[model samples]
Target: MEAPVYTALAERWQDQAGLARLAERAERRLREHPHGDLTRWRDALSRLPPVEPSADLDRPDPRLGATAPDLQGLGETLMDLHPWRKGPLVLGGIRIDTEWRSDWKWERVTPYIDLGGARVLDIGCGNGYFGLRMLGAGAELVVGVDPTLLFVMQYLVCRHFGGDLPNYVLPLGIEDLPEGLGGWDAVFSMGVLYHRRNPMRHLRRLRRLLKTGGTLVLETLVLPISRPGDLLVPDGRYARMRNVWAIPGTDRLLGWVNEAGFENARLVDMRPTTTSEQRSTPWMTFESLEQALEPGDGSRTIEGLPAPVRAVIVATA
Candidate 1:
């Protein structure tokens, strides 16, 4: 029932008392053979009896355009969805962006969100690195929502590592945004909105989930300026990419945040990511700074701005 119990029962049948007996026996056997396989040395662990799997793990909400994010049957689901990260795909000429690990995501990003003693919502929390970190750092409550099986499976692993047993990790999306969802102090979404078909719709939905004066912290790709006007995400966008709209400039981003019923919209930082990197790494995929900004051309998106294809936006609700 408890988180540790699952891992323990699944692997270690030796109880505390059994451990003591094993230790005593090992001490006695030390003179005979001190260094061999531990499995050879210990009393065998008995198999744990199986229990029925939770039906809720596979439950789907009605409105999400995609299927309920499958928390069950995830091993294969993840392999299919995350094909970029492994296997025979590696031998082909194709490259996968592998730089998802970051100096910022672990250290700077989580702390800046500041979830301590606060109710927090992490939209599309893939692998939930922030949720685990927030719980370890003392969040009063933390809820992570994501649409991919890979993200949910990783979240389940991370939660157990944080010590609380899971009730469930529900699959959810912008279309299924819960009613009466306010009263949270903060909402954090990073690198996820762009994947949606309607990013502005996703922005507006954040307002439904935040308390008055709550903050939304986001990191995303923005379009570099070609001239005085806004740039459209060129016409032939990928098929599975439903929305993939690129906010033309920081001004447009700030405008959207304000329109979404938020004040104090601001651009916090800018940096180059894997957008242009050869796609060997699984995580580093992004709208590369070079291609996005075309920095070499001495180009500016508008009259005053230097081209920064990606930007971080932090706004108050």
Candidate 2:
């Protein structure tokens, strides 16, 4: 896939010396990590017909332009990049019903955070779906970081149709970002905290990424507990996700946030994930929420862990 332009840094990050270095580091990482499927994804992106990019981002599906004349060919090319995880994007008259009805999650998050003219960092941002929504909600620039090459390629596809807006998905993980560059207006860590072995360190790093009084919007799997500091360290995989390390109670997470030096940490929204919100679709035919949970019992995973009940927490740095 072609490297996305990192010009968004020029707008606000020009004053931060490290952000220029960050742009260079991101470029180097993209150049060095030559994913084996890069050529295939590039070909898929190339197949899209050239058209003026037009988008309506303030919608559930985030419509992009109109139907291509060769709709079947357009759909086929998009299908070449499969396993779409984080969107229900509509582009070129094709509605990609992704594995996750991410719009539903966005709806829950939108009311809690204000992105107006803010620079944001979205960790584990899959396909830049939320980044697009952030821009639609008035964010000036959204610098998304995700290590998954497939997700990065998927973002390039979105950019192809959505035009080169301020939404950028860099093929770099949160750890790849340079230290001491803390001036983000808002930082988001969604569906990422549980995967970290050192949750406190993760929280601290998130704090460091934001400027003073910057907002941190965090969403992650949470379990209810009778007392603060209670945590669930799954002996093995929870809900078939191997990388999930810990699921904390909302109170425990808030405590961690406070200990990380964030102020006014509070839970904004909490809800159980349902099959309707995340399920197998034509665009992502692999097993999803349905297969991950125990048969007939929706409240628990097949492994008998509490089913994925996510919580959104907001705090100020």
Best by lDDT: 2
Per-model TM values vs. the true structure: 0.57, 0.95
What's the true lDDT of residue 96 in model 2?
94
lDDT of candidate 1 at residue 190, scale 0 to 100: 70
Residue 226's lDDT in candidate 1: 44
Q: Which lDDT tens digits does candidate 1 get at residues 173-275?
A: 5454446456667787777766766767778888878888888987776765444565456343422233555545667777877888888887877554443
> Which tens-of-lDDT digit does each residue in 93-207 have in candidate 2?
7899999999999998899888999999999998999998998899988889999988988887787788878888888889988896779999999999999999999999999
Which portions of model 1 miss their true places by more than 4 Å?
Answer: 1-98, 106-112, 165-169, 225-228, 238-243, 275-308
Weakest ten-residue segment in model 1 by summed lDDT = 55-64
